[model samples]
Target: MGVIVDEQVLTCSIPPARFFKAFFVDSNNLFPKILPTVFKSIEYTEGNGGPGSIKLLSFQEGSGADVMKHRIEEMDEANLVYKFKIIEGPKMGVLDFESVSSVNKVEGAADGGCILKSVVTYNTKGDNQNAIQETIKKAKEGFVGFFQATVGHLQSNPDAYN
Candidate 1:
């Protein structure tokens, strides 16, 4: 019915502390500031963004990802990583699938900027093989844009994000 998808070494370059904010921003004031349209708003219906929290993220336009609701299945601030399972919005059905967005590395460069490698894996529900494939491809492009935009954002406001 479904299949698991994986992406390895998906890389991007961003200013130092940019990726840190991705994982550290307060759920209430994070996405809108860093990634506006990509993350329109987040409502923490349950806990306060820690593990086991529930959130609804509204995406603007049709930026490939659209929008969805997710539950924080796992989180590690120290390691700067988190895993959340998609609970609603575009999965295919009720409890259709899940995803993991993990930051493999957040390191600084001697010259400037940071190299960020992230792995985003997905598993689709039964009989949704085609959708799973499409989703994986979109994830790749989205990551590239995300990296470039993040870097541009920091570079534009130097003092704010660097």
Candidate 2:
């Protein structure tokens, strides 16, 4: 199998604690309410919201309306770090990958905003590596979009999540 790894740092104007609370802590319920167009719902199929938990992310009606199942590999609330792996989903079809894992570390930036360090790894079946890169690109875009929408929602209604 072939492996593809990528690391990216994304900056946002939202504070680290608030962003993590809304995006990671309360996402299971808040995501669908805030961004129903992108996520239909997020449910826990196994465990709770901690490590080893499995979440099924159902997408809204769109081009590829498929549910992606992910298992939480690690979570550190104190450090604002989270890691998970896609155990099942159409995303696995991108490069016939055996597995796709992502690690996200959120830290407070000097500007009072936050910086997200994202690392994505893809384990493919063969030497075909082009699609692996494309998949990572799409994943990064999705993460950015999710954060942007969450920030927008929080901005419009300051007390919505707090």
Candidate 3:
């Protein structure tokens, strides 16, 4: 299997703690509400909400994916770090990936805002470098779009996640 790693950083005006809380901690609840066009719902299938837990995420029609299963690897609230692995999804099948995992860290920036750093690792089935790169690029763009939408929601609501 071929292993591919990618990193992305996004900066926003929200504080690290609050951003982490909204984006990572309460994402299951907030995402479906805020981005209904993309997410249908996120429900825990096993093990509560901590490490080893499985979450079944259902997406809306035309979103390019129907459902995805994610296993929580780690969630460090105090440190503002989260990690998860995609165990099942149509996107994985289409991309020919054996496994996909991501680690996200939120840190306070000097400007009183926050920076989100994400590292994604993809285990592929064959030696299709171009296909893998394209998949990774699209995934990163989706992540950024989601982050921007969540940030906009939080910025406008102010008291929503607080």
Candidate 4:
């Protein structure tokens, strides 16, 4: 199998605590409500939400319309870190990957904002590493756009979640 990895660090004006609360804690409800154009819903199918739990994210029609299944590998609330593996989804088809793992870490900034570091690794099925990497590059653009949209939503309606 082949492997492809991507990493990114994003600086945002939202505090780490609030960011995690809105994105990870309340995301199941807030994501769909806030970004209806991108996501349809996010729900747990196996466990309540801790490690080993499985969650399915259903995207909006034409926004892939894919149900991505993810298994939580680790959750460190104190440090604000989350790790998960994507077990199934349309993304697998496009990249021809056996699995995909994502690790996200949020660090509090002195200015009440935060820096988010994200690492995504793709395990491919064959030798089409170039093609897979290209696809992943394109997907990352959309993913970043979605993140920006979420941040905008939170900033504009701060009390909506608080």
Give the top-scoring candidate (lDDT). Answer: 3
Ranking by lDDT: 3, 2, 4, 1
Q: For model 1, how big is the CA root-mean-square deviation?
A: 3.5
Model 3, span 6-56: residue lDDT tens: 999999999899999999988899889888899999999998779999999
Highest TM-score scorer: 3
Q: Give the per-residue lDDT digits (tens) of candidate 2, residues 40-87.
A: 899999988899999999998883647999899987888999899999
Model 1 worst lDDT run, 10 consecutive residues:
7-16
Spell out the clash pairs found in candidate 3.
none
**Candidate 1 wrongly placed segments (more than 4 Å):** 8-18, 23-30, 33-39, 61-66, 94-105, 108-112
Can you tell me which runs of candidate 3 are displaced by over 4 Å? 93-95
Taking all chains together, each candidate's TM-score versus the true structure is 0.69, 0.89, 0.94, 0.89
What candidate 2 gets wrong by more than 4 Å, as runs, is 93-95, 160-162
Measured with C-alpha atoms, the lDDT of residue 97 in candidate 2 is 87
For 2-67, candidate 4 gives per-residue lDDT tens digits of: 777889888788888778767776678878887888788999999988999999999988875478
Q: Each model's C-alpha lDDT?
A: 0.61, 0.83, 0.90, 0.82
Clashes of each: 3, 0, 0, 0
lDDT, candidate 1, at 79: 55
